[model samples]
Target: MKSAARHAIDLAGFEAKFRAGPDPWHTLTARDEAIKRQRILRALGDGPIARILELGSGNGSNSQALARRALKLHTCDGSASATQLTRQALADAPNAHAWHIALPAPLPGHRYEAVVIAELLYYLAPRAMQRLAKDVANALAPGARLVLAHHQIEFPDNTQRTAGIHDRFINALGRSVTKVRQFRSQRWIVDGYRA
Candidate 1:
């Protein structure tokens, strides 16, 4: 009961923060954020991805970056304000599409060449994370890549630790996915997997 209430409060807070400020996380100015984005971009490489789905793309910062490299980019978030901000930020990018959608929900029928989930997994409950892993596997095209990145440090809003989250993700993925690369800094951990 307490957990459920806290979850609702957290979701509301995310929306409120986005409505009040475009850079709720200061992703636009943070050096750590820049480094994390650069590393994810490097993992994506120079090749043009056919389709990319980015979950929890606050203000479309990372989505805009990926839109430049992808033929089509779908960025989604639970917060309406965040989605609106993302749409506004990516308005110039013809390839990007920003939508408001909650996590652990049904994915589109089509598969994607690449999918990125950054700084969002820990917010989901354990069951939701399990469902997400399956959804990610199903949404990936053959030999497609999935990038999972999360903050290593503890935070008040997180539902699970980074290590536990990644462990469950890999467990849920089972033999269907293979890890390709991993990067760890003092602040964050990023892992790339192939399906």
Candidate 2:
């Protein structure tokens, strides 16, 4: 399917899913999600992050943990309900804020020390993915890191294949992004890129 066509269809599907309830991907209860979270944290290392951005923060489970470590954390999701759930989940975390954003749109105005895209890339179409690559490149501060994690198995709703999604970013960023770490499991692949 074309990028725009797929985006429209997926947006409607996702909106309904978000409206139904948070944790659409069951991140809170899934063992794989937990492992993915741990791997991402490990990839980020033990450095004190001044500011971080988490794209497609589904239910804020990861956001809550990241908020504890960072001085400031901003999470964005395409679904309004998802963002609301994220806000509620991180309500007591003074440093965290969740915003509702449609995919392919511009990121927040501030540059980030670390940007995370976990289990979110495959859902984005080709055009949106290009925009994301450009936006992320522009949004990263000097020596900032971008972590991308995704399920290796293709899903019906996925607009792009897992390898293709990651490859696009690697190709777009080129020498500007350095591969910091990579971990692969039977179900998921996590890669960290520093710019």
Candidate 3:
């Protein structure tokens, strides 16, 4: 319960800043997100993905856009308000499921062709993040893809602190590793996937 409380605080902090106004970093982050999401989905080739799951949908801009094209989707956040705002913003996409999910659980138990996670992974504690990565890897079906992005620096882990072991452990999995963008100053979105 203590860990859950702390995770909620992290989510709340991001949600609070998002509620403040249209943030430029978020704007820049959105641009990068769009490019990566498109590239990955396209790279998966021409097919409408059946089921979609997202770890942090933020304002739901990405989910709304994806759902319009006819894909079933579920998105969750640690912040209740994030879910509230996402539902409101995504009213147009009736099939997109929005919920609140705490960390280190079974995770969203639905195999997906593609799993999308944006900048939220870095906020997790190292051990918690490990559980998340493994859970996500197991949740994906063969030929499935996991799109992960983070505010990466030259160091490992995140801006909060560098944890190379965790980062390397994630990299060691059977996944493609690459750098995405630097829209938000020094932060880079690193991607991993399974063939």
The TM-scores of all predictions, comma-separated, are 0.91, 0.91, 0.70
Task: Evaluate all candidate structures by whole-model CA lDDT and list the values in order.
Answer: 0.83, 0.83, 0.61
61-151 per-residue lDDT for model 1 (tens digits): 7887899889999988999999998999899999888878888887653699999998898888878888888888788999888888888
State the lDDT of candidate 3 residue by residue for 4-100, as single tens digits. Answer: 1222336556667667753424633676656655654543345677777877776675667656543788888776666776787778787788887
The weakest ten consecutive residues by lDDT in model 1 span 1-10
Cα RMSD for candidates in order: 3.3, 3.3, 6.5
State candidate 2's TM-score.
Answer: 0.91
Q: Between candidates 1 and 3, name the one with more favorable lDDT.
A: 1
Write candidate 2's Cα lDDT for 1-195 as tens digits.
543333333767877888887777798989988998888887776877999999988778799888987899999988788888899999999988888998668887569999998877778777778778888888899988889988888665677877667888667653488888998899898888888
RMSD of 2: 3.3
